[model samples]
Target: MTTITLGRYLWERVYQIGVRTIFGVPGDFNLQPLDYIYHVDNLRWVGNQNELNAAYAADGYARIKGVPGVLVTTHGVGELSALNGVAGALSE
Candidate 1:
């Protein structure tokens, strides 16, 4: 029997969809999931200066890669900070 954490399962799905890199800013709420990134082969984590920057980076990556890019952010304040970038991606 093999057991995989939710973080690993989600990351596997992201990888299956051709996402080679993930962008985000580390935070107290997200530290646990970030740990799973270290164990996934061929998956790279790019830590940005802030949530907004991470969102922008992910959007740019998706544009260049032709596959959806993934971004991880903490709840509340983190999410709020990334909204402008997310909105930009959506409007584009």
Candidate 2:
């Protein structure tokens, strides 16, 4: 029997959807998941200065690539910091 990890499963889905790059800030909480991302075939990780900037980068990538963009961030403050950028993406 083969065991598939949650991280691997998530990345597989992301890659299946045509997301070649993922943007985010690395955090203790996200380190394990990032490790999985590193091993995924054809998926690249783009580290950003902050969660807000990561969100903006994902939005721009989505606009240019015509595919849905993805951002990964830690819980609490990381998620909070990304709210403004997400709101901007939604409004524009």
Candidate 3:
């Protein structure tokens, strides 16, 4: 059996659902996973200035494209910053 990283599993699941664009803010924690995740797939990475912006963009993309938009961020603070946009997306 082959081992698959969390990143690869996420990429595969999203890709299967027609999610080709990933919006994110790369940080030390997430950069490595970003590199490992997307390289194996034909996915486009859309870097944003901040985690909140990335989340908003991903949400918008999801609405426009009819597919789930992925937002990648680091743990704790980074993920917290995106909650507003994520919550908004969920409310709509």
Candidate 1 deviates by what RMSD?
1.0
lDDT of 1: 0.91
lDDT of 3: 0.85
Off by over 4 Å in 2: none
Q: What is the TM-score of each candidate against the true structure?
A: 0.94, 0.93, 0.84
Global lDDT of each candidate: 0.91, 0.92, 0.85
Per-residue lDDT for 17 in model 3? Answer: 90
The prediction achieving the highest lDDT against the true structure is 2
Q: What range of 10 consecutive residues in model 1 has the weakest lDDT sum? A: 69-78
| Pairs that clash in candidate 1 | none
RMSD of each: 1.0, 1.1, 1.8
Give a tens-digit lDDT track for model 3, residues 19-73. Answer: 8899988888877778866555688888999989999999999999999878988
Over 1-92, each residue of candidate 2 has an lDDT whose tens digit, in order, gives 99899999999999999999999988888899899987788899999999999999999999999898899888778788898889999998
